[model samples]
Target chain A: MSDTGQHSHDHTPRPDQDGPPSYYQAMETAVRELLIEKGVVTAEEVRAAVEAMDARSPAQGARVVARAWSDPKFKARLLKDGSAACAELGIDMGPTHLVVVANGDKLHNVIVCTLCSCYPRFLIGLPPDWYKARAYRSRVVREPRAVLGEFGTEIPDDWEVRVHDSTADMRYMVLPRRPEGTEGWSEEQLAGLVTRDCMIGVTLPKSP
Target chain B: MTARFGPGDRVRVRWAHPPGHIRTPYYVRGKTGVIERICGSFRDPEELAYARDGQPERPLYRVHFDRRTLWPDDQGRAKDGVEVEIFEPWLEPADAAMEGGT
Candidate 1:
């Protein structure tokens, strides 16, 4: 699928933009300018980095998930060393140790960073706005079932819900269970069913 | 450096509230849990945040805590567990206190 994720939507000033730039935003700009001034990093390199980050989307993670669903060996490798498994797919997770958790019949896993909004940005791109919000960062760990419920994901009482707190150097991604009735489907077709939210452990991939 | 804790070993998080850029969450402070896995160590985040080279890296473990134990309420199920990445400095052998007495 060659579709760029940039969809046309009504552009408007965000609610948070009612005031001046945040202190952290100003600090980032100041540091970036100083780095460019000192020739530490070129302006072109900065632009390229941002370009690469934006170019990344959930499709990369979807491909990895689809491959894992199709290949058991690859899945095992993925569960063992998430960073290495992702590298095999040519997805570079720079300076981050990845931990991929698989969702099974009796187990469900969710990812959160109670300290901050730490996410596998290299594979899935930047996190959603809500993921960075204080409410999500705080409440998800305290009341995961209720938070999952808010996302319309209902975990059965008998099932085990595992919440992964990405509090350190390790980043996490959920390997969602494949939908049923999709036998004989190609990896490309299977990838189409995996959504961003599915990889985030907020919801499950629906059968098509 | 060799890891102090291994998988399935019961350990308790350090209860001290020293100020710094800490990765250990406030909720898991002083809680007891079993080590799930040894996620090879890296530079101390507390020092790294202050732009210092956190030399002599410490071992980091993925401690698995029961969700109900962290939050004792009817909202969470018994099977639910929360795994947090904690450095060696913030953890101690839970059985350390029970030993050398009996």
Candidate 2:
């Protein structure tokens, strides 16, 4: 197996920027060792979970956006049932509600988890550091349009913006409005424009 | 499992501060909003966090609150809103007074 891109951040005790394990690291180590010692979960299982996390990336979500752009029926299905529609494209969404809020002419959508960092790992992989930062977690819910603006996305004043706070089990994705001037583009070509931020609703899909 | 609130139902989040692993945010406690969608049933996260079975699964809903309601100092132009995932136990029927006051 390739060692590149084979690292997991979820629950992984990473060293601080100053180059030492923080208290959280020590705590995580202790907890992990104890859990393993009790036979609750094997060390092998932990390694496998890390590998699975490593395998996931934004490309999975991009594939779904590309399919939706090319197929209207599929777009409708995705908006109606995100998990099932993703499954149709061979994506295995785990045990959580994958809610897709479509971006329309009159409305925009953004997502955040105020309590903790709960991202759609199956679709878009690990979230960026900014997404999990304390400031972002606190500010995004209160001022989403402003947050989007910080990302260089300018939404008109007229469009109603909706900030989705993922307080619990449900995970949300912003189905960005399809860009113009790309009539009859192949799904592969369309997928190129979908960035992780675009899928997250901070940015729009790039135009041709 | 039957759902207590459907889409468009106006509800008030009960303001309680019971200890240990709450999914509800502190800012949203005792807030009022409308149901955006039903999220089906799941074991209570509060109980699940403690390794409890969380028997009798509870229904979760996507609740939408007006931005002005959530943050009184919001500077947005129009009626931009915030939607949150809330379990059934935390929500109750919203009254006009509660909506306007809180």
lDDT of 1 at A39: 98
A40: Cα error in model 2, Å:
5.7
TM-score of chain A of each: 0.89, 0.85
Query: Residue A190 CA error for candidate 1 (Å)?
Result: 0.5
lDDT of 2 at B76: 81
lDDT of candidate 1? 0.90
* Cα RMSD to the true fold for all candidates: 6.0, 7.3
- Candidate 2 per-residue lDDT over residues B29-84, each given as its tens digit: 88888999998898999999999998789999999888787777777866798889
lDDT of each: 0.90, 0.87
Give the per-residue lDDT digits (tens) of candidate 2, residues A68-121.
988999999998899999999999998757999999988888888888899999
Best by TM-score: 1
Model 1 lDDT tens row, A97-178: 9999999989999998888899999989999998889998888788888999999999999999898999998999999998
Q: How well does candidate 2 match the true structure in TM-score terms?
A: 0.88
